[model samples]
Target: MSVASMLKNNKLSKAICEASWATFKAMIAYKAKWYGKQLVVVAKNFPSSQLCSHCGYQNKDVKHLTLREWQCPNCHTRHDRDVNASINIKNEAVWLLTAGTAGLAY
Candidate 1:
């Protein structure tokens, strides 16, 4: 459902809507530093959800949040949307790390 719909239906609250993502990121950064690890922030518009983790095929048609599961047309692989997104994000991070460009802020 849309954020506006959720807010109207009381499924989402105003405080949550006004929360600062930067504060959350700062908290994660501090925690990661304390643990002697790095925190990587991906670009805001990265298409993690639309990418096929198995074959690196990007399905531009998967733009709606309602699509919770989909099949990769390229590889014919069935995927849970969230699981595929997580894998794609992880792979992207790893690629950035290996390519020696992870430190460059987006």
Candidate 2:
């Protein structure tokens, strides 16, 4: 998670500060290194929550946290907010891995 970006919101700033995201990320990095795995860090501002995983449509209306469910206008696919975001994150990581090292070995 991007602590800085999250901290920008007044509602989440305190909770974000208390979450120790830096420590969590450090642990993840350490584990990845120990396991000989490459860690792909996506951009902090990537709109995972707003993007439709099935159709790549950006639903700007889903910006509010209260909207836990949404439908993609482009593909008309119903989506659970968190599920869609996780899928987008996974897709982005896979894309980054392939595009960043197209000719290189893992």
Candidate 3:
């Protein structure tokens, strides 16, 4: 709402994110690179949860209770939040490279 309120909220959100970055990054990065899979870190603004990995469908409805678990309504496939996001990030990197838009979109 107000400038101060916005700043306060931003700082709090950023602090929470910083605390989890290492663990999340390590989990995805290591697993991906371990088997010769490219690891990608998409821009933080990318919407992973809202996109369906199986169908390229996007939705606005998000069930917070299933933050770590979800089934894509369009395809009836279950997804693990972090895992799907990581895969999506990797795809994005490859897509960017092929599209000649970015050397590393991640």
Give per-model TM-scores.
0.79, 0.77, 0.55
User: Candidate 1 — which residues are off by over 4 angstroms?
Assistant: 1-19, 103-106
Candidate 3 residue lDDT tens string, 1-106? 6544654785676666675786787777777767876554467778877777888677556536467777888988788877877777777878876776653312
Whole-model alpha-carbon lDDT for candidate 2: 0.86
How do all the candidates rank in terms of TM-score, highest first? 1, 2, 3
Q: Write the per-residue lDDT of candidate 1 for residues 35-95, one digit (tens) a residue.
A: 8887776777889999999898999878889999999899999988899999988888888
lDDT score for candidate 3 against the true structure? 0.69
Candidates 1 and 2 compared by TM-score, better number? 1
Stretch of 10 with least lDDT, candidate 1 = 9-18
Candidate 2 error regions (>4 Å): 1-19, 101-106
Instruction: Quote the positional error of residue 25 for candidate 3 in Å.
Output: 11
For candidate 2, write residues 1-106 as lDDT tens digits: 6768889999999887767876787788788788998778877798999999988999999999999999999999999999999999889889988887422122
Sorting all predicted structures by lDDT, with the top scorer first, yields 2, 1, 3
| Residue 60 error, candidate 2, Å | 0.4
lDDT of 2 at 71: 90
